[model samples]
Target: MAAVSLTAVPARADGPRPAVLVLPGGGYGHQADHEAEPVAEWLASLGIHAYVLRYRVAPHRHPAPLEDAKMAMLQIRSESSGPAVDPTRVGVLGFSAGGHLAATLSTAVATGNAALDVQAAVPDLTVLCYPVVSCTEDVHQGSVDNLLGASPSDDLLREVSADLHVTAATPPAFVWHTADDAAVPVHHSLAYTGSLIRAGVPAELHVFPHGRHGLGLATGDPGPDQWTSLCAAWLTRRGWTQSSPSVM
Candidate 1:
């Protein structure tokens, strides 16, 4: 099983708290420190349980990471009725390549088998930060090569590109990208957002004027720092926050 570090606060007096599965992007090379524990801590501070998944990458490839993502979702859902979490409210958030993984889960359908379906591991909601949504032209080459290998087949490429797979059944998404990101172009998010809209799935997207790729939390970057606050508000709007709906 993939390693999952749980960050859970005490259960609220009212009921089970909502939770998020956080995936940090590293171009399928490794997980980012800034995007991992820091994000979990922030969510926990808001009374929402968080799980940081140290999913396999690089040498592992494709379905391997996806499988890990599914496992984490299954584990969280398994304890949904427990005091620790609200199964139905579980969601996912990812940065860059991790965003691609999260998007894959959002669009992936259940296979109808208990073990394989794993109770249909799709997240109730998704947040993609500068995600590499395409395996084609808009792709992040390093991430594509790492995940799908060099010279992947056209069919395989199409199959893995999360944007091409969106459907009305896919969960709503909140996506953000900086226009100046050279590594993973902003168009990736734009195209994915367009697909979501065409499929009638609820989606929100923000395109900032400047910021580089992999700027997790964009701490000191004034423009990108707003993303955190905006995302918090978006979460609140969906009632995913542990406390009453209010922007953090």
Candidate 2:
């Protein structure tokens, strides 16, 4: 079973608070540490309930990771889930391969399981950081191999290529990548953001000139660190955060 580590804030007297599920990148083989807890803490600092999902990785394959994400989303939105969060305000933030998973969840349809409410599993917003968005061009080979096996067919590749799945129903997104990201390439974000725009979903993309891939929060790095502030401001505009962007 996937484990969810919660970092919750006090319930607001106004109404249910917004919540976010953090998914760390590890190329679908493991979860990255830096992208997990610290990211959740930052969201919690903004007065939003945050949960870090350690979803299944390699040896699990395709639907397994996606299923775990869906289950986590459902758990977060459930009335009895222990937090006073607005079900309609749930979102996701993912990095690297985890960002691919987040995009998949945002664009995928329900699995036809009567027990799982599709609406509950879908995110209202999405944040992708240095994400792997394609299985074809500029593909992250390790992630593709782990999630779909070493020999994924063309049909399957298209199926998992997140940028190819965007629709009008896809959630609005905020995505950022370094222009020189050699690992996954900035084209991934460009393709996904373009698809979102074509689908009429609100989206934001930022390509930094420097910084290597997997710079979670880019803590000490001045240039890339601006993503946090920009994202916080985006969240505020979307009414997910009450804090001023400057504080981030």
- Over the stretch 1-248, how does candidate 1's per-residue lDDT look in tens digits? 34445444333445777788999999998889999888877777666778888888888767878888887888887874444778788889999999989988888833334564553598888989999898876768899989988799998888888889898888899999999898999999998999999999889999999999999988999788998889888888887776565322
Clashes per model (N, Cα, C within 3 A): 0, 0
Task: Estimate the lDDT of model 1.
Answer: 0.83
Each candidate structure's TM-score, on Cα atoms with residue i matched to residue i, is 0.90, 0.91
Query: In order, what lDDT does every prediction score?
Result: 0.83, 0.86
**Tens digit of per-residue lDDT, candidate 2, span 1-248:** 34544444443435678889899999998889999988988888777888888888888888778888898888888857467888888999999999999998898734446555376799999999999999999888999999999788998899888899899999999999999988989999999999999999999999999989999999888789999999988999887876433211
* Winning model by TM-score: 2
- The 10-residue segment of model 2 with minimum total lDDT is 4-13
